[model samples]
Target: MPIITRFYGIIIKMYFNDHLPPHFHAIYGEYNGVFDINTLEMTEGDLPNRAVKLIREWAELHQNELMKIWEKKVFKKLDGLK
Candidate 1:
């Protein structure tokens, strides 16, 4: 897994050549979730409400970049939520 960003104790990552539907992983404390890049929906696992909110906001801000990285199968760090 490659870390895409980190902020407010939230760590965002994605796996190279990962499965379909284009998604990313978020880890905060002991909670973790796999979020769909397009819909911002948690496909697996669970996260706190605050963490989910932050992840959604951050994803909205960088959706395009995320897709680009996903399509290219290249990982790059992204700016986290402020």
Candidate 2:
């Protein structure tokens, strides 16, 4: 997994040549969730409400960039929430 961003103890990552629906992984401690880039919804796994909210906010801010990276199957560090 390649880390794309990190903030507030949350780690965001995406794997090269990953599965469909264009998604990224969010991890915090023992919690992990796979979120759809288009819908910004958790497709699998679970995370705390607060973490989920923060992730949604961050994702909203970088949705386009996320899609670009996903389509290119390239890793790029993104700016995280302050």
Q: Pull out the clashing pairs in model 2.
A: none
True-structure lDDT of candidate 2: 0.95
Which candidate number has the best TM-score? 2
RMSD of model 1 against the true structure: 0.7
TM-score of each: 0.96, 0.97
The residue-level lDDT of candidate 2 at 47 comes to 97
lDDT of 2 at 53: 96
Q: Give the alpha carbon lDDT tens digit for every residue of 1-82 in model 1.
A: 8899999999999998888999999999999999999899999977999999999999999999999999999878999998
Off by over 4 Å in 2: none
Task: Tell me the deviation in Å of residue 13 in model 1.
Answer: 0.5
Tens-digit lDDT string for candidate 2 (18-77) = 889999999999999999999999999779999999999999999999999999887899
